[model samples]
Target: MEETISLKENYEIVKKRIWLILSITIIAALISALVSLFVLTPIYQSSTQILVNNSESEISGFDINDIRTNTELISTYSVIIKSPAILDIVIEELELNRSSGVLSSQINVKPENNSQVVSIIVQDANPTLAAEIANTIARVFKTEIVALMNVDNVSVLAEATVSEKPSPIKPNPTLNIAIAIVVGLMSGVGLSFLLEYLDNTVKTEQDVEKLLELPVLGSISQIKEQEENAFVSSQQNQPVGSVTIES
Candidate 1:
């Protein structure tokens, strides 16, 4: 038969298995920490910003409509930044041991909203190489776009550089541990509830009364074996009803 439980009983069940729940949470956190610190590869990222022409002053001999056109052309320029027209030259200039496709995969281009500024970002296992790629891609894209479009509109706004201490941008350890802790706690509580639901043994007089629908005439109290033996010996040695019994 099935029965409903109150919040107090649920709380008691969890309290009884609190250690198991805590152990699961700790194990999950430790595994996440280990993977974030040692197992996963560290990827370093660098970014460089460039500017697209918004005025004829930035590029000689252009009218107001041309300025708007150039601003709209920013999206096309973003695509060309990763194309072989730019990346092939970049690979040859830096003597990098990667194909144009592979090098392009590590780079990202982003343009400012309703503005002429563009940002180039690159990621690599080596920190110095990441910065070098970011800077070189911007230079090559700027020079190549001039030749391709017959306009001098691109300019470097900020260059990517390596600091004294560089940090990877992926596999955030603390965040990972926090998520694992929440998941582990939820799993443990669910398992505790499931186990409690599966248990059907009668453990109390109330359970018997409810299941059988009858009054309990009496109950046999439990006694330890040593105490029972001692009580029996004492009873055997004592007189019953104030009359000595012969053995």
Candidate 2:
């Protein structure tokens, strides 16, 4: 059977150090919020989709061969979109100071499974630049594929538009704070248990009996300072005409 803690023991543990636990949790959440808000760079993402089917030829019936061929070719198209062939041209056109390698790292080409549509997603610090890059990548890939592979089937299905107010897709503040709270709570509880375990000084008569493995015959009552001083004064007064009065 799994070991279980009594409710009273759990309550005592929590009550003993509730302030420490709350302080740690609140501090952790605040730190996480601050990091998400100001410390880390916010990355804005924009996406554009490209359709890799015959735009010229319109068919009424579904062609399995063409569908399979289009889906299979989309994988190669994904690689070509990120290759230096297209990215280098895009860099020159955009006049971006970054290298093709750096730009490639920020771009992601994701193709839908068993579909001819490919999504070109760009992430940048500037929201407008991210949207421009996404659109430019799709436009550049369309132009380059015809020259590189003599293929003209690829076309931009939807152009990327810049948002007036774009939010970052990374470093989610709420999620980060939630995770920090859990981490802080665990750390606080673990530290509390560690401190409890390390504390071994006896505090009760039962502890003395348990350690000595003998019955505790008696325990000395703790004497207050006032009572001790009175006893000493009475002893001094006994030599100078004093009478004892037992309570």
Candidate 3:
């Protein structure tokens, strides 16, 4: 015969270990909150906007073809901006001790859609350094592109600035705690079920019936120490019976 478990049985299993489940979940959330608050490093991000414009457009007036050309060149500009050709100068100018490969990993270049504007984004542990790196990268790219591509159109539109109260872009404690809670709850439930399955001792009539596959004829009630002592005292306090003989 196929065996099956009802919803009541599942509820009972979870109820039996409710405290264990709750303890594990609470501990997991607390650990996650602590790590997010103190253990993980906060990474701050800064971005600088650079515009790719046709210098001749100012003299010769605006043209759609020039705009399209500048927009198309943005893809190439993005690559060059991250290449050693540009980052090397940026590092040297800023006197950064890190190598180009490491610095390049921290930088991201993105071009605005259908526009001749490119954004240089950098992330660092220090907010001030993040802003400084972003601005330095834009400046270095603008100067070097003129020499490398023979174009004098690139200009810094907005420089990255550090706010008085800059917030880190990641390590959100709320999100981490939320995820930890879910994971912990799932783990607790799984462990609860596992422990229930591994336990073979029968503590209830249902367990005995299930294990033996037989109906119970009777069961003995368990008496506590206090109840047993009370029974003995009542028996001793009873008057001794005297037998009377008929004369």
**Top model number, lDDT:** 3
Could you give the C-alpha RMSD of every candidate to the true structure, in order shown? 5.0, 4.3, 4.8
Local accuracy of candidate 3 as per-residue lDDT tens digits, 1-247: 1234577788988999999999999999999999999999999999999999997446777789889998999999999999999888888988999999999999999887768989999999999999999998888888888789888889999999999999999899999999999999999999999999999999988888999999988999999999999887877887789443549
lDDT of each: 0.87, 0.88, 0.91
- Candidate 1, pairs of clashing residues: none
Q: Per-residue lDDT for 93-193 in model 2, tens only?
A: 89999999999999999987768899999999998999999999999899889888877889899988876788999879999999999999988888777
Stretches > 4 Å off in candidate 1: 1-5, 54-67, 205-247
Q: After superposition, how far is residue 79 of candidate 1 from its true place, in Å?
A: 1.5
| Alpha-carbon TM-score of each model against the true structure | 0.78, 0.81, 0.87
- Model 3 residue 75 CA deviation (Å) reads 1.7
Instruction: In model 1, state the lDDT of residue 242.
Output: 64
Winner on lDDT between 1 and 2 is: 2
Better of 2 and 3 by TM-score: 3
- Candidate 3, which segments miss by more than 4 Å at Cα? 1-5, 57-59, 238-247
Q: Candidate 2 — which residues are off by over 4 angstroms?
A: 1-11, 55-62, 215-247
